[model samples]
Target chain A: MELIIDRLTKQYKNKIAVDRISLTLNKGVYGLLGANGSGKTTLMRMLCGVLKPTSGEVKFNGIDVSQEEYRDSLGYLPQDFGYYPEFTAYEFLLYMASLKGLAKQSAKDKAKELLELVSLSDSAKKKIKTYSGGMKQRLGIAQAILNNPKILILDEPTAGLDPKERVRFRNLISQLGTDRIILLSTHIVSDIENIAGMILIMKDGQIVHKGGLDEIIKAIDGRVFECTVDAGEAGKLISMHTITNFRQENDKTFLRLICDKSPCENAISVKATLEDLYLYYFKEVNTDEKLF
Target chain B: MDNNIKRKLKSVFEAPMPAKKDDFLNQLDYPKASRLDFIKSQAGYIRKQVWVLSLLLFIGTLILMYYFEVSDSVIWILSSALPFISLVSIGEIFRSITYNMDELEMSCKHNFLEISLIRFGILGLANLAVLISLLILLAGKTDFGFFRLGLYLTTPYLLNCYGSIFAVNRLKNREIVYVCGVVTASVSILNALFTTQINDIYTDKYWSFWIISFIILAVFSYKEILKLIKKMEELKWSLSLTV
Candidate 1:
């Protein structure tokens, strides 16, 4: 049940959307975190076999990505997908089930079961055009898993979800991750913060960091500093450091920032959080990585 | 809420039932859909507009047959619309890609081509049905007998097919394929008007030429369709690679 991506690279004319990247995964939930245009979608597309790589390949066990048997184990939800406006939610899932080679009666039962799982059973008979964005995204999630795929890939699956819906979606994903390989890509750091067993932080078309949350946070451990300064001094510190947070109390301002060397006399070192680690790794200017 | 509705609501928010989950995966008795099932489902999805248009074409044919004495010119004019119907039927097959379902369809185990071909066959049958009905309406009334009627009817329809299949491979926008169809139908009509074959069907002089031309166009159309399928898959995969 191992999925191996070997040196996958996609180039368009002079620009490289996804640079050479490789990874291997078994059954678990892995989060791909990156800013826009950072190649998360591109990599996920390659994994799902919707897009081919220019120089490398993805294999499920030993089977090629282009092979039908490999696809039989795959379920993918792209960043942008369309549904037939005329189709009822149940009908749409049935169509997708057929495309995946499911038996007709089983497909119908599966469609009913999935719509219920996604909490769309009440509206399964209604046309999709009448559904809201969150409902549609839930439907998207349901269809991606209708085949009971061994490998499920979702790109920005929470884009249109509300806060509560996002939480429900995360719980669903966390439960599914115990047996299957689930790879989800998103820029929302917190969306994956609680559920993902491992995180891959990407930047400039490459994975700059890959590890468990605590391990990655350890990289910036001694670098985060907390200090209180007056308005005039806070302005000076802001110019010279990457400020993660700041709030004014009394006449002084409390500031949290990342720096190799302390920016002020009273600044005390604090533990690094995932957000701080993210800012440290992907801020406008590249930072020194003396700590691994 | 009723007690039953309340229970259903509670179940929806709870974890998916374990029994249903196992049944979904372990149901080996579930038979895979045969080719006939695919064809049936494809036919089920055919657009309602196609049915409406087919009815209108039939009514139009009936009216024209009742009023005008069937002649080569009348047969030629009525047959012009057949090319457009053929174009529309093919357009229906391309509708999924137009609506952005191509990405999802291509990623499935069966892939896009299989579903597309099934839908194409269904629509192709609809197109055939309309053509045959038109021929039957003109069967006894027109001096243009079976062979000649078949030639006139097939020539333009085949030309439309050829033009559409050829354009689809080269053009990015699906609308351009319709433009190719318009050109094909126009040329066929103009040729039928001036060419002596339509007026002198009794003579065997041009029978061989028409049969030969029809065969050549049909072969070219089939090859173009194959090319269109290959080109579409290649382009999508290549575009994905570069994107």
Candidate 2:
């Protein structure tokens, strides 16, 4: 299903969490990349029908979300999900399924299937209170997919996961994006770099950039440069270029830096990445291109 | 030419399939499900209270039988406790229902005010208990009737206590009000029950006191109900904006 978000706005007292942003999302993986407090979570919450916006309309396939029919095709995983401490993993899933109107036998079968899908089948009978953070996140993912929703919104789904689990979750999301509109929001740039069909960069409640992964990288084209300088000269290079990140070897400093195309003695060209683009957009400087 | 034929063949095989009907059962109307869920959840709490009160009354009946050496029939006393127990259970059930409704609103999910009239049903049972107790006393069986009245009075007091505890736990902002209301109402009922001078007053005066006490209790409980209703309204507004 396609989702249309029209002129969405959410103001908290004097601060605007989302400022009249609008976008149309179709069946693909859309990555919302921003720093913390950039309104990404608030936007996702509005889309999920959890937090109301000051002014906006969210419609799925031309159906308003206030109608029950829209909810039938929607799934959401909030950033901080609460669960009944007294319920076992299986029981909790069953309860949620019951709320969704699934019959007892089918809910049971779906609960077991989801637990296996999230690799939590062994802990299905265990109380949720005893689960680790990663396990709880996996369970949250399982619940979001229970109904095979058409529009899925997941906020920071892989925040606390280990490297292996993170890879597994990303792969799962990639597979899910084939027939559904999956919107994944996170501050981690690398998480969405490889999978997002389009990347939306937000800052101060406004989308600063929207394009494919290669386009975002291309924004910083010819600006990324690497150079090895003696420790004494490193300080000068740092002041001249936007130092995105750096590595050091004995007696020399290697820097991944961004600067307009210009003569730099011994500086070599390197490919820009999503992280480099993120730093370019979020870094604070007096230059016109500096995001902050 | 070969590519065009291959594309045509792919289109023939890949035409969208016809839509399938939902295999799952249709969702029950939320209002209907909410009412049923409320009743089912209350049944558990009410059942527990009935068991406790029944046990207490059964023991009391046996003790009275032994002390008075009255063997006309023990069935009457047992049967008398039945209506009283049911009345008390009804109050417990009402409290349970209100508690769940409050919880549903606090979580900002659904509305339940339409079902709130259920509370008056419990209040009616309170009135019935008092009427039965008065009838027994008028029949000239002072001892049995007074004891039954005491049991009947305990129902409302305990229900108020349970309701206050539930309100305090569920609505954090109004805990003090709920607690004070429960304590004051229970104290008034207890005082009416034990005071000899109060008992000697006219029957109309006694009934008026009970009526006034309940009215005050209802008024206090209604404040919390209003708070719950306001919260539900806010949630609904929020849902609309977000959706």
Please tell me which predicted candidate would have the highest lDDT against the true structure: 1
For A1-292, candidate 2 gives per-residue lDDT tens digits of 6799999998877888899998999989999998777889888877766555689899999987555566656667767666655678998776555544454566678889889999999999999989999998999888777666788888889888888999999998998898789999987788889779999999888888998998878888988998888877888877776788878888899888898874268888888999998888876622534544
Candidate 1, residue A143: the lDDT equals 87
Query: Best candidate per DockQ, number?
Result: 1
lDDT over C-alpha atoms for residue B238 of model 2:
40
**DockQ by candidate, in order:** 0.45, 0.10
In model 1, residue pairs whose N, Cα or C atoms come closer than 3 Å (at least 3 residues apart or on different chains), thus clashing, are none
Most TM-score-accurate candidate: 1
Which residues of candidate 1, in runs, are more than 4 Å off? A246-253, A285-292, B1-31, B136-140, B173-220, B235-243
Which clashing pairs does model 2 show?
none
- lDDT against the true structure, per candidate, is 0.81, 0.65
Name the 10 consecutive residues with the lowest summed lDDT in model 2 chain A.
A283-292
lDDT of 2 by residue, B105-207 (tens): 1211221232233333544454455445444533343443554454434435544544553454364331345344544455444444444334443244466
**Candidate 1 C-alpha error for residue A181, in Å:** 0.7
